[model samples]
Target: MPPPPNYPASARRNGEEGVVLLSFLINQAGQVELSKVLQSSGSSALDEAALSALSQCRFTPATENGKAIAIRVTIPYVWRLNQ
Candidate 1:
């Protein structure tokens, strides 16, 4: 799947960088099951957008002994505005 769209232009205009810490559950089918924001950027809009984008992502499920298994993964999203 394609990457999530960039944050809104207004977010860029604000010129703030937010680090979103996300915890996601990867299922055996290589689909994302659950995603939660472990750390927020103090901006609800940015946090929600990051979560939404992540939900659309697909990943390779972790394997153990050559078998797929559910696992939790942490992802960090850094949004920086170009000056």
Candidate 2:
């Protein structure tokens, strides 16, 4: 599994919680590129943190005809504070 984002202290204190939907490219090199937030988590801190963390992930590049290719994908990062 990819590493999880660090919860921002201010956001945590404010009890902010939501899902950040992100669109990004997984390049042929299995590296993340050209990421954008497609949906906000209602908190900039959470959104930014999700972006920063997910950007560090390395994905298995999509393959076609036994060759790697870049692909654009959308995924959600969920944030919630424990009760």
Q: What does candidate 1's lDDT look like per residue over 1-83, in tens digits?
A: 32654786666677656888889898998888778999997677778888888788888878999999999888888766652
The number of the candidate with the highest lDDT is: 2
lDDT of each: 0.78, 0.91
Off by over 4 Å in 1: 1-4
Question: Backbone clashes per model, in order?
Answer: 0, 0
Against the true structure, candidate 1 reaches a TM-score of 0.84
- Per residue, candidate 2 scores C-alpha lDDT tens digits across 1-83 of 35888899999999999999999999999999999999999999999998998789998999999999999999988898973
Each prediction's TM-score versus the true structure? 0.84, 0.94
Model 2 lowest lDDT segment of ten: 1-10
Query: For each candidate, C-alpha RMSD in Å?
Result: 2.4, 1.4
The top-ranked prediction according to TM-score is: 2
